[model samples]
Target: MSDFTQRFLFDDFDARGELVTLEGSYRHVLAKHPYPEPVAQLLGELLGAAALLIGTVKFDGLLVLQARSTGAVPLLMVECSSAGELRGIARYHAEQIGDAQSLGELMPNGDLAITIDPANGQRYQGIVALDGANLADCLSTYFATSEQLPTRFWLFADGQRACGLLLQQLPVDRQKDPEARAASWEHVVTLADTLTAEELLSLDSETLLYRLYHEEAVRLFEPRALQFRCSCSRERSARALVSLGREDADQLLAEQGGTVVIDCQFCNQRYPFDAADIAQLFAGGGVEPASDTRH
Candidate 1:
């Protein structure tokens, strides 16, 4: 399968933007979970949003977008790193779902949360009450309230494809080209809003840009590929077992017949630890597991 793709740009004036569309990669992530239509769509949107944000930010860090509800869909978490790696998982109360058709109907009081884990700086978090009728509205509200920038976002996804657009207002020197900046931002967003879901899902970066901004003078950079990658492993699980204390680990191992197994909810990958694995993990004593070192 091809990697997920991200396209980025800055207006000749002061604003910046990104357009990201994912099909095969997004479908691969969603395939692990048998989510309802609304939940599945939400997961795809979150994945697109996370990829876009990761493309925009500068860090060897992780950007996570999460939506939680006490309603039918209990939890949805999407993680994207600076390198364009993506993974997501969703949990739901199947009994409560009861044939719900949309996010609003399924999660009456959902909340959206954004977390930025920078490699060097302190972790940051932003939370917003799910105000909009959909995930896009909720995230737009988040940007307006939390970032306080004149930002606009459009996100749409079906069970098969996910797409998103992000426009952010960059602070300009108040005296120079302010009019040009405002005009450019509005002009670009206007064109972007006219985009159809099919256009977003099917077109390549260059074609999509031309379709939207052919008349205008816009700079398009080389597109970066995004990928569906699960950051889970046996070593990480064993470390988690060590954190559970020897007695607790022993109890679980005893109940499970000398092995404790953890299934990654995101990728449906299993990490199992037998007795020797536990002994090795304990012998290492405080050595953290390598989450990035995948087998």
Candidate 2:
């Protein structure tokens, strides 16, 4: 199935939920880098988590989820835009990774960070220690500690696909009956906890929700498409070189035989700057190469 995120509201509960399944997008991220099995699985989970978290807010830019540690896997990060474009990368010691399966094992003393960068406003970031057994638990701790919200997550990823479910308790309003709302929240979460990883990965949103909340008043929103897209371009790459200052750029070009190469880690796309390209960039002109050369 295509990658998509489905939002839902509980008519009987003061809560919200999101279900996301990523197949094509997940595979696209894996294709860009040959991540080891453990790293690939972790990247997939982060990708799903980023997408689900972005849907929780109304923003116009990018949401980034990052984890850093002093372990086999030093860093793993994923970014999802408001428009559903996604990209991710992971850095790890291949031999040190071994057969570790949980977040604690992969990142011994790690910290999780979530950042929201809007197009026209200040960025917001929150950090939490990675004290949970798995990624889902780590994120749950983030929500409880950072947002002060009762949030739960079920995340699963193999090398092939990634899937996630997010459940959050909505803010209480004076008009609503507090006891009723609290009861409903508990009911929904209890049912959600029964979901198995296999069912989450294989079932569609509609079927999955029905199977879990068939008796409840659950309203599922239309699925939004999620895609694998890199925001990298020759222009952006050229601008980066210009920022290094004219003299440094020229020296680098000379050292590399009049050609400077920049590779995007997210998409594995290479941008080569020859003398003409470098000259145009330094002259405050656009990069208009004769042919598109990508490696």
Candidate 3:
């Protein structure tokens, strides 16, 4: 019911913030996959984090956050486009996932990788070894080493819900003293770090800010809407089949009743393409094949 995202700016400080409450979006993501409890919780948090990260970006791009593990949860990936659409999926061993408590326990020696692809420019990537016990710290490392920006994050996800808060420092005017900018950024991060997961997901923007920054003059911005959306289609699937080469595609088509069945791992949407679909793909060229976005 209360499924929306809000972006707020601190009026008197050189700082901005974002808060996301996920209900319908979270449910829609989970409905497609029967993930284990631990994996599900991690996916929810990653999904929220991805949305928060993408919303702040100015250009039309895709923002991806991934957790790679050598343990039960081999890999967890979440993607958010510039339009505020999101999709995610996880891979894990069910037996190993049993009785797992924390994300660290499930993803030992894990790391976080973030990639940004602008619509008209080249993509960029940053990676950091998993150093903290939770997603927040992992992301903290990213901000410190990758962007060098003073940033803070609060992430929380139970078996049912997921939410996050982000605060970042903004550049100051040339006439403004450098010390003033540093101090403002430091103060914002300190207050933001004091936020708890319960407070982040449960309280409204006004109440949460009052609790954290009661002493500072804070300005809140209009909220943004975030939801679950899958970018999948029949033509996309057919193009993918064409990439498999004609011989392989025909053999598979012969074995499977002349149809290729493709399912979207992110949303579980199924696309069925018969021989005729394959013929059209090769005949009418120019449609690019669906490439893997996870790399």
Top of the candidates by TM-score: 2
Q: Extract clashing residue pairs from model 3.
A: 8-221, 11-219
Clashes of 3: 2
Q: What C-alpha lDDT does candidate 2 achieve relative to the native structure?
A: 0.89
Off by over 4 Å in 3: 174-181, 285-295
TM-score of each: 0.87, 0.94, 0.89
Off by over 4 Å in 1: 8-12, 173-180, 285-295
lDDT of 3 by residue, 1-295 (tens): 4556788777776778888878788888888878877788888888888888887678897898888989999899998888888888889899897788687789998888899989899898888887587787788777877766667778887756788888877777431778877888888787777777778767887899889888877777777777788888766777788789888888888999866789888887777666666666767753333332211
Superposition error at 269 for model 3 (Å): 1.2
lDDT of 1 by residue, 114-171 (tens): 9999988999889988758777778777877775777778887888888888877778
By TM-score, the better pick of 1 and 2 is: 2
Decreasing lDDT order of the candidates: 2, 3, 1
Q: After superposition, how far is residue 290 of candidate 1 from its true place, in Å?
A: 19
Local distance difference test, each candidate: 0.77, 0.89, 0.79
**Candidate 3 Cα lDDT to native:** 0.79
